[model samples]
Target: MMKLSMLCCPLLLALPLLAQAIDAGPASPQQQETEGWLLLQSRNLAASPQPQTATPTERELALQRWLKKYRYEIPDFYDPDAGGKVEVKK
Candidate 1:
């Protein structure tokens, strides 16, 4: 019983090491290529595109669109006439 326990102790310790050596198989080439392309495209898009000058009115409209999209809840003290005062009431 002592000899058997000693032999089984080493095998039990090695079980986890053996399990980790199993290969799940190589990743598909298409999946790899798609990931590479996405990474490249994201990098290219992140670089500033050709800067196009916009009129003052167009700029204000763009800002308004951004504010609306973000749902900026302004407070009572926020006077639109007193510049862009963004107040949030908790």
Candidate 2:
């Protein structure tokens, strides 16, 4: 009888702790990526917010495109219809 009491004591104590809980939690994504573009300004405080006259360079365009692919392409990361075969869209 002593052995039975000891075996059940821990579980009995834990039962009450489990009773007081909330529901409806959102599941987190397994893979997540955050991407953004940053512009560095010269120490000339007067040059704040450079005029948009100049267009992005070729390399800059490529980098921005690459960053957009990961940032805006949500389906590629968390596709519900991928059926266990998640494809990484380039």
Candidate 3:
């Protein structure tokens, strides 16, 4: 019983590493499509500013609104050129 338990422990420890290896494949077509969509949305949001006198909070709010609108198809990272870290809320 003790020998069997020791053997199983090694197998268990290797399982997670094996799983990670399998997960590390090239991006699929679907992933590419989604990333493209996110880049577009981020760019659009960054380009269009709020009203001339809008406060920083308002601008961030506006961006968040757009993000929520496109959350489903958008990736976590947006295009930097569109606007990187313009108004990040803690």
Name the top TM-score candidate.
Answer: 3
Candidate 3: segments with Cα more than 4 A from true spot: 21-31, 45-90
What TM-score fits each model? 0.34, 0.22, 0.36
Which digits, one per residue and each the tens of the lDDT, describe model 3 over residues 20-88?
A: 444653379898788877888987754556555889999999999988877567658887786555787
**What does candidate 1 score on TM?**
0.34
Error of 3 at 80 (Å): 46
Pairwise TM-score winner, candidates 2 and 3: 3
lDDT tens digits, residues 1-90, model 2? 999999899989999988966555434342221111112233344464667464568778888888887765445476576667768999
**lDDT (Cα atoms) of all candidates against the true structure:** 0.81, 0.61, 0.79
Compute the lDDT for candidate 1: 0.81
Query: Worst lDDT window (10 residues) for model 1?
Result: 18-27
List runs of model 1 lying over 4 Å from the truth. Answer: 20-26, 41-90
Candidate 1, residues 3-86: lDDT per residue as tens digits?
Answer: 999999999999988876645643788877888778888888645578879999999999999878668665778676867668
Candidates by TM-score, descending order: 3, 1, 2
